[model samples]
Target: MHADPRDARSVIEQDAMTWRQMLIVLLCVLLNGLDGFDVLSISFASPGIAAEWGVDRAALGIILSIELVGMALGSIALGWAADRVGRVPIMIGSLLVMAAGMSAAALSTGVVMLACIRLVTGIGIGGMLACNNAVVAEVSSLKYRAGAVALMAAGYPFGAIVGGSIASSLLVEGTWRDIFWLGAGMTIAFLPAIILLVPESPEIILRRNSPDRALAKINRTMKRLGHAALDTVVPIARDETGDSSGLFRGAMRRITTLLVIAYFFHMLMFYFVLKWIPKIVVDLGYEPASAGSVLVWANIGGVTGSLLFSYLTTRLPLRGLLIGVFAFSFLALVWFGMNATGLGELKTAAALVGFFANAGVVGLYALVAASYPAHLRAGGTGLVIGLGRGGAAAGPAVAGFLFVGGFGLPLVALMMGVGSLVAAGAIFVLRSPPKAPVRP
Candidate 1:
């Protein structure tokens, strides 16, 4: 029987997400989950942690915000380093540090000890995110890139949900230390998989030596993926030829700054909402359990929105798509704050806000990938995403401070909408850097 060429093509495309690919995503997602567990668990466990340590409420917020400081710094620094050195080393090192941070948190005796550990953990999360954001975007085909990035983005909420669930289980039976131990344990789980399977960037391979080995590896991967007809894996160095260094030349500098700003605003609102929503609900006279449930629904909405929008981005003008989504997000936030005071309305809006906000996030990632050429893809990705991490890192800190000032949820959502609008404006100003004509 003769095989269909289309079938083979399908296999090759799907092979981009083969089990090996899935594991890379899964491990990174798990690392995200580990980060989520620690961050979310802190909020859920704060009362207990504060009580046990005899710390004041003000100090606890600082303790929780500590890791974010490290994360923001690590994200920018390590992301830059990945562009200079390589992704794998930075990622692996970050994972190891994350594990240590968790271990430290597990054994922390006072507020100071916990805060120190949280900072370490934040740094580790930052490093891992910076590298992974670049690697995952560059590794996949353009066809599935948005979906892959969005799916990864969804991991945080899922992880938070998992953390919350675990918190419920442990609230009576165990201490907050148990949550840290589990989070750390998960970090260790991914180390072996990451070391073995995550390949070096193909672009890096091409520039380091003759293209032969790189092409050979591509051929080998293709063959394993059941494709033998791929005559060339290297495109004729079109679209701003040569390496991460090339980003500093021509229009790249201006564009790079825009990307950095875009990412920062995108993360600002996203991280703020993610870290604080449950707390906000609790403050609104709901029980901890009820608040957790609302947050869980929002997270579910976020995952759904990410999946839906990611799929949609491949077919639409991705940048414009983000603008529209965020506009909808602004509208949703207004409605959520106004009409959602009742139980039913609040629940409905919780899901919508989660979906729209995360969907907007997915669109931001797609835009990041499309903004630059392949040579400096990782660095360009890192530069923008690292800037975003600044906001993500600052999110908890800012939100915690704002909550203390007696701000309501309405104002919080509106403020984040401002961040979304800023992102939309920056994206509007961008023109896709020159593209080569496709052969028909």
Candidate 2:
């Protein structure tokens, strides 16, 4: 009897993962890590850029916010486009955009020019994130999907660490322009590997094309993935009666809304820590270099947290895991706020906050990937992420306002702590989706 290829998830679930599949996941992780470098490179180079441009901290803040706006736009638009087009093409195109933008940014003479370039770069980073998350999830077996996504999530912090180290060393001998140039060059270097190794999602081809075309595409992908060719392709059974609005309809509407709320509040707290933790450390009497090191430690914690989350998903329900993570994040923030003062205490607090917050966000990505159907996965993921960028953008600004409004560090910490609690509550109320079957 011929094997049924109707359900893409079933095909992946039935096959034991091979080196080819592992390579696809690794490629995605590397791409996302590069994106992390690109996204946070501005932060690493900002002091040098500001000094050269004669701009103050406020001006630099504007520069940061503009890129977030571009990211929000890119995540929504390109993410939806990935569904209609394909993930690989979108991923490649976005990388090109990032390279061009970073290269242009290196030559920018004025703040306005640099801001525009950063916006373009942000668009590329944001678009890549949504597509990458969906593609990684699609290609992995159910048994390993969470682990794969968690590994991919670690790429961001890994990139940040790599970018931060390079920028720190290069800044002693070079200019901010040198940093952007290096980032651009590094991104371009990955193009060949991506084009050679990554295949378009088999699910996308089968969902969007005619049977003849789908069969050919499926066989091509299978061969690339080191699997035998299939005799034929059958489309996954799905109700076509619903409106094309995708994730916003029926049960998905509730799920989408809850995810958006959770993402927004979680990001609000997350960006707050990421953007301000160093400054907070400095205010507590640490040297600038020491403060920076603390931030790096936090990112290291993020990597650890992501890997832990991957392992934990195997042992716990998604909803409970996320809720617990967010709850712990809130407590960590409160602890950091109320008691962290000495060097050791500050470092420990930062790591704890980073661990829980970053893990919570990655958990959300995994949950979103598993909840949506293959056809709508990228778009749904994109929409939620795009909306969440609003919170990410607002986070730092709100924190700044709180500082200006005479809120002490403790108070500011409490406010962010509240955001985490709200996020936890959102997850707490969310109804978990029914478990999908894993075919042997």
Candidate 3:
């Protein structure tokens, strides 16, 4: 039987998931994994950069956060582009920019040059992340969407785990430049994978393309996914489908604002942990290789937490579960600050912090996916993440200044942990989001 072209979203929501859909989700995971490694590559390499250049902690903090500034720009700009052009196209373009940026970073002669390259790399990573979230959500069955998104979110820590392990080994026998080289090669390798495998979102095609163009594209996607093709296509009006401009409309404006605030606070805490763990370990008198290992342990904990959260979503209410995760995350960060004295203690505490922090991250990913309407999904996610990155950028830089200013680790830890608590409070204030309007 011929299917209603407009019901394509319903098919994705109600029917059994096909391998094509699963492949798309898996690719999203890998892309997110790339984001993980690229973001932390500097973290893994920071000690060497500081040592080689004789840069102070305050300077180093700026270097650590400069890319996040670029990320903010990329997320807002590329995210809006993803909504306008297409998810796959923006993603493919992001990979190219990332590869080039990483390659340039490997050849940098000065701190200024490297920071500039890293900023460029952040632009690619930011755009890629915004697109990946939207693609995974749009393609999954409703029953499995949260789990799938959680799994995709898990890729961040998983990439950190794998990349950290390799980077630790590299640090033993190679200079920090080797790390960027590896990242560049990996980013280049994914270019072909995306081109050959991934497709544009049907919902996006319907909203943005002309009726004839939308029908052909949607049918091609449907055919690949093993679904029946439709004889006619009714293109969704731009106004009917909603857009980024609508994000601030009466009720949605409140949800968008609160969600962005929550994300901003949580990201501030999360990046503080991820960015500083390696440096913190190095300061404790361990070798850089060992420092990388400690960071790896954190990512290991992150993966564990993300997967567990994915499982729990199937059996529990997401809103309550998310708030609970944030509560524990705040405690874990404070505990890590206070009790991680010895190497063994440091590893254990890092893992605990990672567990809660990353789990909360997965929950936030799911929340963003569910909260926005279909058309605004990518843009909304990008807006939240882009602005939230202000916190991510601030976390490391703020901690650095605090360290320079004579604040103890415990006090700084307590201060950063407040981000998660504030995030939880924001989530609590937000009521159930209004459902998206149905297309005629």
The TM-score between candidate 1 and the true structure equals: 0.79
Clashing pairs in 1: 67-118, 70-123, 71-122, 71-123
* Candidate 2 lDDT tens digits, 273-361: 77776556656765545555666777788889988887777677777888889999988888888876687788788788889988988
lDDT of 3 at 303: 97
- Model 2 spans with C-alpha error above 4 angstroms: 1-10, 240-246, 278-289, 337-345, 370-377, 432-440
| Predicted structure with the largest lDDT when compared to the true one | 3
Against the true structure, candidate 3 reaches a TM-score of 0.93
Name the regions of candidate 1 deviating beyond 4 angstroms.
1-19, 22-32, 50-61, 83-85, 134-146, 205-250, 285-287, 338-347, 431-440
Candidate 1 on 116-190: residue-level lDDT in tens? 778778778888877766666555554565556666777877787787676656655677677678777878777
lDDT ranking of the models: 3, 2, 1
Better of 1 and 3 by lDDT: 3
Candidate 1: residue 438 lDDT (0-100): 11
Model 3 poorest 10 in a row by lDDT: 431-440
* Model 3 agreement with the true structure over 9-107: per-residue lDDT tens digits: 777787899888898889889889989999999999999998988888888888898889889888899988887799889999999999999899889
Local lDDT at 329 for model 3 = 89
lDDT of 3 at 56: 81
True-vs-predicted CA distance for residue 264, candidate 2, Å = 0.5
Native-structure RMSD, model 1: 5.1
Model number with the top TM-score: 3
